[model samples]
Each structure stands twice: as structure tokens, then as C-alpha cells.
Target: MVVGARRVTRLLDAVQLGMVVLVLVAPVAWMVLSAFKPRTEVAALPPRLVFTPTLENFAELFQRTDFLENTVNSLIVAGGSTALGLLLAFPAAFAMSWHRMTWPATATLFARMAPGTLFLLPWLMMFTALGLVGSHLALILTHAVITLPVAIWVLLPYFDALPREIIESAEIDGCRQHQTLLRVALPMVAPGVVVAAILCFVFSWNYFLFALVLSGFDSKTAIVASFNFIGEGVTNWGALMAAATVIALPPLILTLIIQRRLVGGLSAGAVKG
Candidate 1:
């Protein structure tokens, strides 16, 4: 009976693991499948698992809109925001770690937890007043709020985990504070920075609300441009899915390439602490 019960538990555990894999893969599989189907086939009363696949949706996505340009815009916004946020957040994270300050970190947490809408109105009004509305700067600035917080938080734990003795040794060796940070501390925390950068890039790339409100025609990201798929006359499901597939490719490829490093980076501070 004990052996029988153990076998039953193992079988149940296998089933649970399979369910978890399905939960994660199902949405992505559906999206890929939708991107290939015809509009009618997508909404076919009884869903068809297989059909005639066509590239017509992709052709339409590229031909009917500025999809390529918007792709470049997403790259710029995400790249720029991640870089700038890292620059600003690194110093702040270092200070917070050095000082052992919790209030400052808590304040950042509060900002992140607050209703996003609450800040939007005032930001819009201020941007409009400054003639910054509908510009890349406005979008970049709003993204910094998101990117900076994430970068700071990710870096904080790593910074705190570093040896105070090492820092003191560097100081004794006549390294200037900033020099120590740049040469000694930063390299040790580089993996954490990379993890923070990846998170920032993904968040900035996927961000819709700020781009939708703040970006002009020249600066609009692929995510906002995909909105064109929803027309007043009719929604083009196939075209929308195709655009989504194309828009998601950059980050997807990016994540796949760096996934190993990202995993390592995330584990760095935890073991040290």
C-alpha cells in the first residue's frame, strides 16, 4: 500500500508538471498559429488546428503601415532608456547600499506601487507646458521611471552583498571613490547590471501607455503602431497577429541569446548574501 501510494504521488506530480508546461506554451502557440491563419479561419466557429498557411498577413502588415520604422523606434526607446536608467540608477543603488538606507529604497518601492494613472495626468500637463509633449524625450522620460526603478532594485541586492573589506582595501590603495566604483565594484556587479538592463529593455520595449500618449509619428514604437490593426470599420485579426509576431521577434531573439547570462546574473547576489 505504501509503494502504491508513492507511485500515485509520482504520477500526479508528472501530470502537474505537464500542466505547467502547457500553461506556459499555450498562449505562445496560439499566437504563432493565429499569425498564419486567414481572418475567417481565426474566428472559425469550431477552431481548426491546421489550415493553409499564408504570408499574405505579413505582406499586408509591412505594406499597409510604417511597421519597419516603428520597429526601429522600439529599438531606440528600449536601448536608450536602459542605458540612461542604468547610468542614473547605478550611483543611487551604490549610495543606498553604502549608507544602509531603507527609506530611500522604500520610497522607490512606493513610486513603483502607486497608481500609474496618477502620475500620467501631471506628466502630460507638464510635458505640454514645456513643449515636450508628443516627443521622444517625453516617452523616454516616462520609461525612465519604470526602467530606473527596476535597475536600481536589481542592482541594490548585488551591491549590498559585496564585501565591505574589499571596498576598504580599494580605498587604502588610493582609489578614488568613483574610481573604485568604476573599476572594482562595477565589474563584480556587472552580471547584475546585465540582468537589470535586460529587464529594463524588455519593459521599455513592451510599454504601450506612455508611447501611445507621448510619442509623435516620428517616435511612435512598434507596439503603438500595431494599434492601427484595430480600425473603426473592422479589426484585422490575422494582420494584428502577424504584426505582433514580428514585433515580438527582436526581444524574443534577444532573450534567447542572453538567457544563460541572465540566469547567472540573477543568482549572483543571492549566493553571496
Candidate 2:
């Protein structure tokens, strides 16, 4: 009886896992499949599970639109913001962890938790005044607000997990704070840094609101440009799906490539040693 019950539990677990995978993967699968489908098949009465794939949508996305340029713009913004966020966050997180300061981290979290809309008007006005509206600089700086807090939070745990004895040893060895951070501590927490950077890049890459409002024609991101496919009365379903597939590629590839490290980094500091 016990053996039979264990089998039933195993079957139930498999079913639950399957359901979760389907829920998470189905939309992505549909988007990719639809990107290859012709326009008629994309919007067919019942979605066509079998159809001859076409490259027309991808061709149109590249030839008829500035999506490639927009993608470059996104790369610039996301990369710049990620770099900027890490530069600032690395020191801040280390200091916070060293000093055992929670309020500052809490404050940054509060800033992050606050509505993105709250800062939009002020950012718009400031950027306009500075003549940076619609520039990559504006988008990068604004996206930093999203990336910075995330980098801080992700790195905080790793910093906390550092050995106090090692840090003190560095200090005794004539290493200044920045020296210790750059030399000793940095190497030890390298995995956490990778995790933080990937998260920051992904967050900044996917952020839509700031880019939409701040970007000009040349600096518009792929995500904002993808929105153009939708119209009041008519939408280009095929092209939209193609654009989505394209836009999703970079982050998707990055995550898949580093998934093991990402998982390890996240779990690394969960328990105190």
C-alpha cells in the first residue's frame, strides 16, 4: 500500500511539473511558431498547428522597419545601464554589507518599489531641459534606476556571505577599502557579479516605459518599435510576432547559456556559513 501511494505521489508530481512547464512555455512556443506562420495562418479561425513556414515576416521586419537600429539602441541602453549600475552598486553593496547598514538598502528598495510612473514626469522634464530627450543617454540613465536597485539587492547577499576575517586580513595587509574590494573580495564574489549583471541587463533590456517616453526616432528601442505593429483598426500579427521573436532572442540566449550559474549564484548566499 505504501509503495502504491508513493507511485501515485510521483505521478502527481510529474503532472504538476508538466502543467507548470506548459504554462510557462506555451506562450513562448506560440509566439515563435506564429512568427514563422503566414499572416493568414497567424490569425486563422483556429490557430493552424501545421503550416508551411515563411520568412516573409522576418524579411518585412528588417527591410520595411528600423527594427535593427532599434535593436542596437536597446543593446546600447541595456548594456550601458548594466555597466553603470554595477559600477555604482558594487561599492555600495560592499559598504552596506561591511557596515551592516540596512536602512540605505531599504531606501533603495523603496525607490525601486515606488511606481515607475512617479518618476516619469520629472525625468521627462529634466531630460527635456537638458536637451537629452530621445537620446540613448536619457534612456540609459533612466533605465539605471531600474537596474541599480536590482544589482544592489542581488549583490547584497553575496557580500553578506563574505568572511569578515578575510576582509580584516586584507585591511591589515595595507589594502585600502577600494583595494580590498577590487582585489580580494571581487574575485570571490565573481559569480554573484555575473548573476547581478545578467539580471540588470535583462531588466534594463525589457524595460519599456522609460524608453517609450524618453527615446527619439533614432534612439527608440526594439520593444518600443515593436509596438508600432499594433494599430487602432489593423494589426500586423505576423510582423509583430517576428519582431517579438527577434527582441526576445538576446536575453533568452543569455539566460539559457548561463542558467546554471544564475541558479547557483542565487542560491549561494542563502545559508550562512
Candidate topping lDDT: 2
lDDT of each: 0.86, 0.90
lDDT (Cα, tens digit) per residue for candidate 1, span 16-126: 999999999988888888889987798786888889998888888888878888888888889899998999999899989999987877788787898778889899899
* lDDT at residue 243 of model 2 (Cα atoms): 92
Clashes of 2: 1
lDDT of 2 by residue, 1-273 (tens): 999999999999999999999999999999999999988788897888999999999998899888889999999999999999999999999999999998988899787888888999999999999999989999999999988999998899899999999999999999998999999999999988998899899989999888878999989999888876664222778888899999898889878867986777657646532
Error of 1 at 226 (Å): 2.0
Candidate 1 achieves a global lDDT of 0.86
* TM-scores for every candidate against the unseen true structure: 0.88, 0.90
Model 1, poorest ten-residue lDDT window? Answer: 227-236
Clashing pairs in 2: 134-216
State residue 120's C-alpha deviation in candidate 2, in Å.
0.6
